[model samples]
Target: MLQFRLIVPADLTDEVAELITSTVGATHLTLLKGAALDPVGDLMTCDVAREAADPLLAGLRGLGLEERGLIAVDSVDMSLSRRSDDAERDAPGDGADAVLWDSMAELTEDESTLTVTYLAFLSVATMLAAYGVMLDSSILIVGAMAVGPEFGPLAGICTGLVIRRKQLVARSAKALVVGFLAAMLVTGAFAALLDLFGLFSRSQFERPHPATQFIWQPTADSFVVALLAGIAGVLSLTSAKSGALVGVAISVTTVPAAANAALALSYTAWHEVLGSAWQLALNLAGIVVAGLVTLLVQKWVWHRQRGRAAATSPPAP
Candidate 1:
């Protein structure tokens, strides 16, 4: 459930109260008349089930409350009221399936920004993978995969595409591109440093590393894995099953492939560089495509659910 706090204009107090009362999954409305000093209106609060939040928020926005007043939403971890339970039961769909689009947009916007912390995480992950690749250590590779922050911008790009936000797409794309490029370059320089310390050698990298071969070998299965990961990633963000994101993080070889590409570049291994780059591109494309499709389907399903609810609802006299 979500809790909403609104400062409503004096004239719209009745309309706001009526809207909340009529909403199927909203309950516990509290109105304080003329309580907002700055806005000089009423202070109203209500609880709404997640499934009904989008439409309720849309209704409020349509009333010009956003421009004239203030709207704030927070998650409710626990609600002891029986009406809250009834509200959840009466809502059209499951709370876990609901997509709080406004919240998501804000989330992705923050995550997709190109920040120092983002770069630091990506670079560290890439360097770790560089060591893993040279040493042919699966443990280090997996650790690097978990540490990589590339998924944030990838998800941002997918969300932006589904919501038709061009600026979001641009920002996310820039973050993805610059983050990877910068990380790979840093990894390449780090690999050269390892060579200087006699810790890395061309022959060591050329040795058959059976466990880590998938990082450089682009097969159809690579794209398939990426597609599945993308679906899980988006589901994690939109739904309540966020823990699945760890599995999604480790399942893709994006960081490993980037590390391999950087290592191969340091050694002037054209074939390895090309193969790893192909693997990286294939995984990224698959994740983006799958995420886009998943979000579109979710949006469609929720729209239909709302339509069905509206059709069955009795007219308000």
Candidate 2:
């Protein structure tokens, strides 16, 4: 369930109350009139089932509450009330399966922002991956994948395409491109420094890396794995089941490919660099395509479910 605290204009109180009362999956409604000093309006609060939250939020936004007042939503980790159970039962769909587009948009919006933290994480992940490739350590490669923050911008791009948010699309694209380039450059310098210290060498990169050979090898399998991972990653994001992301992260070779490219560039291994670059490009393209398709499918399914629910609901008196 989700808890919503809304500040509503005085004149729209009645309409808002009526809307909540009539909403099927809304429960535990409370009102405090003239309680908002800043907004100078009534404070309304309610608990809504996750499945019903999107439409209810849309209705509230349509009333100009977002512009005139505030709408804050938080997840209820534990709602012991029977009314809350009934609300969830009465909702049209399961909470885990529901796609809250507004929430997703907000989440991706924040995650996709290009910041120093993002750059640092990407750079570190790539650097770790460089060591992983040199040492032929699968564990280190997986660790790098888990630490990489590339999925955020990829998800943002997918969400933007589905929601038709052009600014979001542009921002996410810039973040992904710039973040990867910056990470690769930094990792290359790190590899060069390691070489200078006699810790890393071109011979290490040239050695047979049976366990990690996929990083620089672009094939149909690479695209397929990335596509599958992308679908899982987007579902995890939209459904708020973030644990699934760890699996998705490890399944793709994005960080490893970037690291391999960087390491090869440091050694002036043009062939390996080109191959790793191709692998990276292929995986990214596959993930974006797959993520966009997954979101589109979810949006379509939810719209259909809403249509069915509306058809069965009784007409208001």
Candidate 3:
């Protein structure tokens, strides 16, 4: 569950309260008449389940409460919530299910933007992937994927698409495209240097490297892997179970494909280079489709709960 602190104009108090109360996902709502600074306003504090947040928030916008006051939603650490015998028997683990619900509801592009650690990791990972693909080293490719930070923004892009957040979509796409391009260029330059010294060549790159061969052929299987990985990736984001993301790290060929393309360009093997480029596009598309669908389902479930709330609650007096 999440806690909301709502401040609204006095004139809209009745409608705002009615809106909050009418929200099926909200519970433990407490209303206040006035605070010193908000004498011309009203205040409301409430706890709401995740599945209920979307529609309730939408209703607030519909009621114009969105513009009337400060509406801030904060997380509740259920691990810190005091347990009681009053804990409902059906509640998901001391209301952690509610916590999970709210967190997912809170998922936004602004929320998913890369942080310092995120930037650092992604930079190193992309570099690693670029070099690995250039060398046609599968082991290095795998290692690069482990380091590449592309997944976060990729996930963000899909999140933006589902939520229709243009800012998020732009942010995510810029990060993905720019980040990969920069990494590839650097890695490609390095590969060119390696080839100039006869360390590797276009012929060498086209030669078999079992570990890096995945990029040579883009199959239906590759799309399936990316699609499944994308679904898992979003699940991790919504459930706040990021630990599961490590496995997702290895499941897609984005970094390797990127490295392959960069190295291919460096070696001037147009065919192998073009193939890897297609591989990158395929994987990115698969993830986006899967991610959009997953978020859509979550949105639908949240919307249905609000519909039920509207059915049960009467309008204000």
Candidate 4:
């Protein structure tokens, strides 16, 4: 369950309470007046189930009591009454099962804006990618893939499109494109500078490293890997199974392929560069398409379940 702290004038509190009380899924309701000294409204606390959060939030939006005897929904947090139950269920080694549609809905919590944390992670991943190529290290490439930040926005985009939220879709797509372009360009320049100094010989790009061969070759297996990984990635994000996310990242080859393209270009291996670039595009498109479709399917299933649950269960008291 989620808790809400709303502050409103004593006079307006009754009407506001009535509005929220009438809102479906509001399991508990209470009102307090002048309990808050803030210039804003007074404080009231209430709880609602997770499935009811969205509609409740929608109902609360209009209560912004900035003027007159105002009402404000100041904050919300999960209630601990059931914390032990959920925490035990989500313990490590147990796959975190989450509702995929609800998971997607959660991404809009902050309205899909890019955060500084994502930029820092992307920077580190880009550097690791360049270093991996320089040292001919598969492990580093995998690490970079696992650490890459683009997936959040990619997931956001898929989620937004499924929910028909254009603002979220636009923001997420911008983040994804800008992050990719910035990382690739920076890594490319670094790789070129390293090549010029003979820090890593250009010969490494040509000598067949079995690890990178996949970047230059496209096959049905590539699509299958991307499709399955995309599905797993979404599921892991929504559920408690985030540990599996690192493996999903490495499996997709997005960051690795981008790094390979930049490294190959630095060495002026035009053919290899083209192949790597194509591979990057193919992998990203595969992930996006598969993610969008998965979310859509999940949303449909969730609605059916919700309908069934509503039909079978009585309304909340």
The TM-score values for the models, in the order shown, are 0.94, 0.96, 0.75, 0.78
Q: What is the lDDT of residue 261 in candidate 3?
A: 79
Clashes of each: 0, 0, 6, 5
Q: Between the candidate structures 1 and 2, which one is better when assessed by TM-score?
A: 2
Each model's Cα RMSD:
1.8, 1.3, 4.8, 5.4
Better of 1 and 4 by TM-score: 1
Predicted structure with the largest TM-score when compared to the true one: 2
Using alpha carbons, what is the TM-score of model 3? 0.75
The local distance difference test score of each candidate is 0.92, 0.92, 0.70, 0.67
Q: State the local distance difference test value for candidate 4.
A: 0.67
lDDT of 2 at 253: 89
Candidate 3 backbone clash number: 6
* Model 4 regions lying over 4 Å from their true place: 8-12, 15-28, 36-39, 62-120, 314-317
Error of 2 at 57 (Å): 1.0
**Alpha-carbon error at 177 in model 4, in Å?**
1.7
Put down candidate 4 lDDT per residue, 21-139, tens digits, no spaces. Answer: 66544545776667867655567766644454444555555564445443223223334555334433322222222253433556543424566767667766877876776566888
lDDT of 1 by residue, 1-317 (tens): 89999999999989988999989999999999888998788999999999999889989989999999998999899999999999999888778889988777778888899999999999999999999988889999999999998888998999999888999999999999999999999999999888999999999999999989889999999999999999999999998677888899899989999999999999998999999999999999999999999999999998888788778877768
lDDT of 2 at 235: 93
How well does candidate 3 match the true structure, expressed as C-alpha RMSD? 4.8
